[model samples]
Target: MLRRVREGLHRWPAVARLVAIAALLLVAAAAHLAARSEPAGRWLPLLVVAVVGALVAGAPRHRWPLPAIWLVATVLAVTRGSAVDPGATAAALGVGAVALVAALTADVVPVLRTRHRRGER
Candidate 1:
Protein backbone atom coordinates (compact mmCIF):
# COMPACT_ATOMS: atom_id res chain seq x y z
CA MET A 1 0.00 0.00 0.00
CA LEU A 2 2.78 2.39 0.90
CA ARG A 3 4.71 1.48 -2.17
CA ARG A 4 1.62 1.87 -4.30
CA VAL A 5 0.91 5.31 -2.92
CA ARG A 6 4.51 6.34 -3.33
CA GLU A 7 4.67 5.05 -6.87
CA GLY A 8 1.52 6.94 -7.71
CA LEU A 9 2.85 10.29 -6.54
CA HIS A 10 6.45 9.62 -7.45
CA ARG A 11 5.85 10.50 -11.04
CA TRP A 12 4.05 13.73 -10.39
CA PRO A 13 5.49 16.96 -11.75
CA ALA A 14 7.63 18.74 -9.17
CA VAL A 15 5.42 21.82 -9.24
CA ALA A 16 2.35 19.75 -8.46
CA ARG A 17 4.14 18.06 -5.59
CA LEU A 18 5.38 21.36 -4.20
CA VAL A 19 1.92 22.86 -4.44
CA ALA A 20 0.43 19.96 -2.53
CA ILE A 21 3.02 20.14 0.19
CA ALA A 22 2.76 23.91 0.45
CA ALA A 23 -0.99 23.64 0.75
CA LEU A 24 -0.68 21.14 3.55
CA LEU A 25 1.85 23.23 5.43
CA LEU A 26 -0.09 26.43 4.89
CA VAL A 27 -3.24 24.90 6.30
CA ALA A 28 -1.37 23.62 9.30
CA ALA A 29 0.29 26.96 9.85
CA ALA A 30 -3.00 28.82 9.58
CA ALA A 31 -4.54 26.58 12.19
CA HIS A 32 -1.51 26.80 14.38
CA LEU A 33 -1.58 30.56 14.20
CA ALA A 34 -5.34 30.84 14.70
CA ALA A 35 -5.14 29.27 18.08
CA ARG A 36 -4.71 31.64 20.98
CA SER A 37 -1.05 32.49 20.99
CA GLU A 38 0.83 30.16 23.26
CA PRO A 39 4.44 30.41 24.26
CA ALA A 40 4.71 26.66 24.13
CA GLY A 41 4.65 26.42 20.38
CA ARG A 42 7.21 23.69 19.94
CA TRP A 43 9.97 24.51 17.51
CA LEU A 44 11.11 20.89 17.32
CA PRO A 45 7.97 19.74 15.56
CA LEU A 46 8.16 22.58 13.08
CA LEU A 47 11.78 21.81 12.42
CA VAL A 48 10.98 18.20 11.84
CA VAL A 49 8.23 19.17 9.47
CA ALA A 50 10.55 21.43 7.46
CA VAL A 51 13.28 18.82 7.17
CA VAL A 52 10.90 16.00 6.36
CA GLY A 53 8.99 18.15 3.92
CA ALA A 54 12.22 19.07 2.19
CA LEU A 55 13.31 15.44 1.94
CA VAL A 56 9.96 14.12 0.75
CA ALA A 57 8.42 16.91 -1.27
CA GLY A 58 11.22 19.23 -2.25
CA ALA A 59 13.73 16.62 -3.37
CA PRO A 60 11.37 13.93 -4.72
CA ARG A 61 13.41 11.46 -2.78
CA HIS A 62 10.78 9.87 -0.55
CA ARG A 63 7.04 9.84 0.14
CA TRP A 64 6.47 8.35 3.57
CA PRO A 65 7.81 11.22 5.63
CA LEU A 66 5.29 13.55 4.04
CA PRO A 67 2.41 11.66 5.61
CA ALA A 68 4.10 11.65 8.97
CA ILE A 69 4.60 15.39 8.65
CA TRP A 70 0.94 15.81 7.83
CA LEU A 71 -0.14 13.71 10.77
CA VAL A 72 2.03 15.57 13.20
CA ALA A 73 1.05 18.97 11.88
CA THR A 74 -2.66 18.11 11.81
CA VAL A 75 -2.67 16.72 15.30
CA LEU A 76 -0.70 19.62 16.62
CA ALA A 77 -2.97 22.07 14.88
CA VAL A 78 -6.04 20.46 16.36
CA THR A 79 -4.62 20.34 19.85
CA ARG A 80 -2.73 23.60 19.92
CA GLY A 81 -5.06 25.44 22.26
CA SER A 82 -5.87 22.66 24.65
CA ALA A 83 -4.55 22.33 28.14
CA VAL A 84 -2.88 19.29 29.64
CA ASP A 85 -6.05 17.75 30.97
CA PRO A 86 -6.59 14.03 31.20
CA GLY A 87 -8.63 13.85 28.04
CA ALA A 88 -6.19 16.03 26.15
CA THR A 89 -3.33 13.96 27.49
CA ALA A 90 -4.95 10.79 26.26
CA ALA A 91 -5.66 12.32 22.90
CA ALA A 92 -2.13 13.63 22.65
CA LEU A 93 -0.76 10.18 23.41
CA GLY A 94 -2.95 8.66 20.75
CA VAL A 95 -1.89 11.23 18.19
CA GLY A 96 1.73 10.71 19.11
CA ALA A 97 1.33 6.97 18.66
CA VAL A 98 -0.15 7.41 15.22
CA ALA A 99 2.56 9.85 14.22
CA LEU A 100 5.20 7.46 15.49
CA VAL A 101 3.73 4.67 13.43
CA ALA A 102 3.62 6.95 10.41
CA ALA A 103 7.23 7.98 10.79
CA LEU A 104 8.40 4.41 11.31
CA THR A 105 6.43 3.11 8.35
CA ALA A 106 7.76 5.91 6.16
CA ASP A 107 11.34 5.11 7.11
CA VAL A 108 11.21 1.32 7.26
CA VAL A 109 8.63 0.08 4.80
CA PRO A 110 10.49 1.30 1.73
CA VAL A 111 13.61 -0.54 2.76
CA LEU A 112 11.68 -3.74 3.28
CA ARG A 113 9.98 -3.37 -0.08
CA THR A 114 13.25 -2.79 -1.86
CA ARG A 115 14.80 -5.82 -0.23
CA HIS A 116 11.79 -7.93 -1.11
CA ARG A 117 11.94 -6.78 -4.71
CA ARG A 118 15.62 -7.54 -4.93
CA GLY A 119 15.11 -11.02 -3.49
CA GLU A 120 12.43 -11.71 -6.08
CA ARG A 121 14.82 -10.65 -8.82
Candidate 2:
Protein backbone atom coordinates (compact mmCIF):
# COMPACT_ATOMS: atom_id res chain seq x y z
CA MET A 1 0.00 0.00 0.00
CA LEU A 2 2.68 2.49 0.97
CA ARG A 3 4.77 1.59 -2.07
CA ARG A 4 1.85 2.28 -4.35
CA VAL A 5 1.36 5.67 -2.78
CA ARG A 6 5.03 6.46 -3.21
CA GLU A 7 5.01 5.44 -6.84
CA GLY A 8 1.91 7.50 -7.49
CA LEU A 9 3.58 10.55 -5.97
CA HIS A 10 6.75 9.92 -7.96
CA ARG A 11 4.73 9.70 -11.13
CA TRP A 12 2.74 12.81 -10.24
CA PRO A 13 4.83 15.16 -8.16
CA ALA A 14 2.51 18.05 -8.81
CA VAL A 15 -0.33 16.25 -7.04
CA ALA A 16 1.77 15.80 -3.96
CA ARG A 17 2.72 19.44 -3.79
CA LEU A 18 -0.86 20.41 -4.50
CA VAL A 19 -2.22 18.33 -1.64
CA ALA A 20 0.25 20.00 0.67
CA ILE A 21 -0.68 23.47 -0.50
CA ALA A 22 -4.39 22.75 -0.22
CA ALA A 23 -4.00 21.57 3.36
CA LEU A 24 -1.96 24.60 4.35
CA LEU A 25 -4.15 27.03 2.48
CA LEU A 26 -7.24 25.84 4.35
CA VAL A 27 -5.56 26.68 7.64
CA ALA A 28 -4.25 30.02 6.42
CA ALA A 29 -7.58 31.02 4.97
CA ALA A 30 -9.31 30.20 8.23
CA ALA A 31 -6.69 32.18 10.06
CA HIS A 32 -7.49 35.10 7.80
CA LEU A 33 -11.18 34.95 8.64
CA ALA A 34 -10.45 34.64 12.34
CA ALA A 35 -8.09 37.58 12.24
CA ARG A 36 -10.70 39.58 10.38
CA SER A 37 -13.31 38.83 13.02
CA GLU A 38 -11.03 40.38 15.59
CA PRO A 39 -10.19 43.95 14.61
CA ALA A 40 -6.95 44.03 16.61
CA GLY A 41 -5.62 40.86 14.92
CA ARG A 42 -6.32 41.82 11.36
CA TRP A 43 -2.79 42.87 10.52
CA LEU A 44 -0.97 40.00 12.18
CA PRO A 45 -0.99 37.69 9.14
CA LEU A 46 0.17 40.45 6.83
CA LEU A 47 2.93 41.40 9.23
CA VAL A 48 4.02 37.81 9.49
CA VAL A 49 4.13 37.52 5.69
CA ALA A 50 6.39 40.56 5.42
CA VAL A 51 8.78 39.30 8.06
CA VAL A 52 8.99 35.82 6.56
CA GLY A 53 9.37 37.17 3.04
CA ALA A 54 12.37 39.17 4.16
CA LEU A 55 13.90 36.21 5.92
CA VAL A 56 13.35 33.72 3.09
CA ALA A 57 14.33 35.85 0.12
CA GLY A 58 17.33 37.25 1.93
CA ALA A 59 18.96 33.83 1.90
CA PRO A 60 20.39 32.75 -1.46
CA ARG A 61 20.45 29.07 -0.51
CA HIS A 62 16.72 28.81 -0.21
CA ARG A 63 16.80 26.81 -3.46
CA TRP A 64 13.03 26.44 -3.78
CA PRO A 65 11.38 29.82 -3.28
CA LEU A 66 8.09 29.06 -4.99
CA PRO A 67 6.31 27.95 -1.82
CA ALA A 68 7.37 31.08 0.03
CA ILE A 69 6.14 33.26 -2.79
CA TRP A 70 2.82 31.41 -2.89
CA LEU A 71 2.41 31.77 0.86
CA VAL A 72 3.02 35.51 0.79
CA ALA A 73 0.57 36.00 -2.07
CA THR A 74 -2.02 33.89 -0.34
CA VAL A 75 -1.72 35.97 2.79
CA LEU A 76 -1.98 39.09 0.70
CA ALA A 77 -5.19 37.74 -0.72
CA VAL A 78 -6.64 37.66 2.78
CA THR A 79 -5.57 41.25 3.39
CA ARG A 80 -7.06 42.59 0.19
CA GLY A 81 -10.09 40.34 0.21
CA SER A 82 -12.12 42.71 2.32
CA ALA A 83 -13.02 44.93 -0.60
CA VAL A 84 -14.66 42.16 -2.55
CA ASP A 85 -17.79 40.10 -1.86
CA PRO A 86 -17.60 36.44 -0.80
CA GLY A 87 -18.17 34.96 -4.26
CA ALA A 88 -15.60 37.21 -5.84
CA THR A 89 -13.19 36.52 -3.02
CA ALA A 90 -13.49 32.80 -3.66
CA ALA A 91 -12.95 33.22 -7.41
CA ALA A 92 -9.93 35.38 -6.84
CA LEU A 93 -8.49 32.91 -4.39
CA GLY A 94 -9.04 30.13 -6.93
CA VAL A 95 -7.12 32.09 -9.53
CA GLY A 96 -4.32 32.72 -7.09
CA ALA A 97 -4.17 29.04 -6.23
CA VAL A 98 -3.88 28.14 -9.91
CA ALA A 99 -1.15 30.71 -10.36
CA LEU A 100 0.77 29.28 -7.45
CA VAL A 101 0.67 25.77 -8.93
CA ALA A 102 1.55 27.04 -12.39
CA ALA A 103 4.51 28.96 -11.06
CA LEU A 104 5.87 25.91 -9.28
CA THR A 105 5.41 23.76 -12.35
CA ALA A 106 7.16 26.29 -14.54
CA ASP A 107 10.13 26.48 -12.19
CA VAL A 108 10.54 22.76 -11.58
CA VAL A 109 9.55 20.62 -14.58
CA PRO A 110 12.17 21.87 -17.00
CA VAL A 111 14.99 21.51 -14.51
CA LEU A 112 13.87 17.99 -13.70
CA ARG A 113 13.89 17.05 -17.37
CA THR A 114 17.31 18.51 -18.14
CA ARG A 115 20.36 16.31 -18.00
CA HIS A 116 23.64 17.69 -16.66
CA ARG A 117 25.50 15.97 -19.55
CA ARG A 118 28.77 17.13 -17.95
CA GLY A 119 29.59 13.83 -16.23
CA GLU A 120 28.09 11.55 -18.88
CA ARG A 121 30.74 9.43 -20.59
Candidate 3:
Protein backbone atom coordinates (compact mmCIF):
# COMPACT_ATOMS: atom_id res chain seq x y z
CA MET A 1 0.00 0.00 0.00
CA LEU A 2 2.67 2.42 1.04
CA ARG A 3 4.83 1.45 -1.89
CA ARG A 4 1.98 2.07 -4.29
CA VAL A 5 1.36 5.50 -2.87
CA ARG A 6 5.06 6.31 -3.03
CA GLU A 7 5.23 5.13 -6.61
CA GLY A 8 2.23 7.23 -7.53
CA LEU A 9 3.83 10.29 -6.06
CA HIS A 10 7.04 9.54 -7.91
CA ARG A 11 5.08 9.13 -11.09
CA TRP A 12 3.61 12.58 -10.66
CA PRO A 13 6.21 15.06 -9.54
CA ALA A 14 3.97 18.09 -10.05
CA VAL A 15 1.24 16.62 -7.86
CA ALA A 16 3.71 15.72 -5.16
CA ARG A 17 5.14 19.22 -5.25
CA LEU A 18 1.68 20.69 -5.04
CA VAL A 19 0.84 18.50 -2.08
CA ALA A 20 3.99 19.52 -0.27
CA ILE A 21 3.41 23.21 -0.95
CA ALA A 22 -0.12 22.95 0.30
CA ALA A 23 0.97 21.23 3.49
CA LEU A 24 3.66 23.80 4.10
CA LEU A 25 1.19 26.61 3.50
CA LEU A 26 -1.25 25.04 5.93
CA VAL A 27 1.38 24.87 8.63
CA ALA A 28 2.41 28.45 8.00
CA ALA A 29 -1.18 29.65 8.05
CA ALA A 30 -1.88 27.82 11.27
CA ALA A 31 1.17 29.34 12.87
CA HIS A 32 0.16 32.78 11.66
CA LEU A 33 -3.38 32.46 12.97
CA ALA A 34 -2.22 31.14 16.31
CA ALA A 35 0.06 34.09 16.91
CA ARG A 36 -1.81 36.87 15.15
CA SER A 37 -2.05 38.85 18.35
CA GLU A 38 1.62 39.62 18.34
CA PRO A 39 3.28 42.03 15.90
CA ALA A 40 6.35 39.91 15.30
CA GLY A 41 4.23 36.82 14.87
CA ARG A 42 2.33 38.40 12.03
CA TRP A 43 5.32 39.07 9.79
CA LEU A 44 7.50 36.15 10.77
CA PRO A 45 5.28 33.45 9.39
CA LEU A 46 4.80 35.48 6.25
CA LEU A 47 8.51 35.73 5.85
CA VAL A 48 8.93 32.03 6.35
CA VAL A 49 6.17 31.36 3.87
CA ALA A 50 7.82 33.58 1.28
CA VAL A 51 11.15 31.92 1.81
CA VAL A 52 9.69 28.45 1.57
CA GLY A 53 7.69 29.42 -1.47
CA ALA A 54 10.72 30.83 -3.19
CA LEU A 55 12.83 27.81 -2.42
CA VAL A 56 10.17 25.44 -3.63
CA ALA A 57 9.50 27.46 -6.75
CA GLY A 58 13.08 28.27 -7.58
CA ALA A 59 14.79 24.99 -6.91
CA PRO A 60 12.50 22.15 -7.77
CA ARG A 61 15.50 19.89 -8.33
CA HIS A 62 16.95 20.30 -4.84
CA ARG A 63 15.88 18.13 -1.90
CA TRP A 64 17.83 19.60 1.00
CA PRO A 65 15.98 22.90 1.19
CA LEU A 66 12.66 21.45 2.27
CA PRO A 67 14.02 19.81 5.39
CA ALA A 68 15.99 22.87 6.29
CA ILE A 69 12.93 25.02 5.76
CA TRP A 70 10.87 22.64 7.89
CA LEU A 71 13.35 22.91 10.75
CA VAL A 72 13.36 26.69 10.69
CA ALA A 73 9.58 26.95 10.36
CA THR A 74 9.01 24.49 13.19
CA VAL A 75 11.32 26.35 15.53
CA LEU A 76 9.82 29.72 14.67
CA ALA A 77 6.25 28.55 14.92
CA VAL A 78 6.79 26.76 18.22
CA THR A 79 8.69 29.60 19.87
CA ARG A 80 6.99 32.71 18.50
CA GLY A 81 4.28 33.16 21.08
CA SER A 82 5.00 34.87 24.37
CA ALA A 83 3.36 32.06 26.30
CA VAL A 84 3.64 28.73 24.58
CA ASP A 85 0.46 26.76 25.00
CA PRO A 86 1.27 23.09 25.10
CA GLY A 87 -1.70 21.99 23.06
CA ALA A 88 -1.22 24.50 20.28
CA THR A 89 2.48 23.88 20.17
CA ALA A 90 1.93 20.17 19.94
CA ALA A 91 -0.59 20.56 17.16
CA ALA A 92 1.68 22.81 15.15
CA LEU A 93 4.59 20.47 15.64
CA GLY A 94 2.52 17.50 14.56
CA VAL A 95 1.33 19.20 11.40
CA GLY A 96 4.81 20.44 10.65
CA ALA A 97 6.15 16.94 11.12
CA VAL A 98 3.60 15.63 8.63
CA ALA A 99 4.60 18.31 6.16
CA LEU A 100 8.22 17.37 6.64
CA VAL A 101 7.56 13.72 6.01
CA ALA A 102 5.51 14.46 2.91
CA ALA A 103 8.17 16.73 1.52
CA LEU A 104 10.94 14.24 2.19
CA THR A 105 8.97 11.39 0.69
CA ALA A 106 8.22 13.38 -2.43
CA ASP A 107 11.87 14.32 -2.78
CA VAL A 108 13.19 10.83 -2.17
CA VAL A 109 10.73 8.87 -4.26
CA PRO A 110 12.34 9.75 -7.57
CA VAL A 111 15.80 8.85 -6.34
CA LEU A 112 14.57 5.55 -5.03
CA ARG A 113 12.80 4.82 -8.27
CA THR A 114 15.92 5.60 -10.23
CA ARG A 115 18.01 3.33 -8.06
CA HIS A 116 15.52 0.53 -8.50
CA ARG A 117 15.51 1.04 -12.26
CA ARG A 118 19.25 0.76 -12.29
CA GLY A 119 19.14 -2.42 -10.23
CA GLU A 120 21.04 -0.65 -7.50
CA ARG A 121 18.68 -1.75 -4.74
Report the number of the highest-TM-score candidate.
3
**TM-score for predicted model 1 compared with the true structure:** 0.37
* Residue pairs that clash (backbone atoms under 3 angstroms), model 3: none
lDDT of 2 by residue, 14-115 (tens): 765554445345435534443334342553464355334333323212323433444555456567856434554464456446756776677676666665
Name the Cα RMSD for model 2: 11.4
Ranking by lDDT: 3, 1, 2
Order of the predicted models by TM-score, top scorer first: 3, 1, 2
What TM-score do all the candidates reach, one by one?
Answer: 0.37, 0.33, 0.48
- 1 or 3, which is superior by TM-score? 3
The candidate that wins on lDDT is 3
Q: After superposing candidate 2 on the true structure, give the runs of residues whose Cα lies further than 4 Å from its correct spot.
A: 1-74, 77-83, 115-121
Q: What are the candidates' C-alpha RMSDs?
A: 9.3, 11.4, 9.7
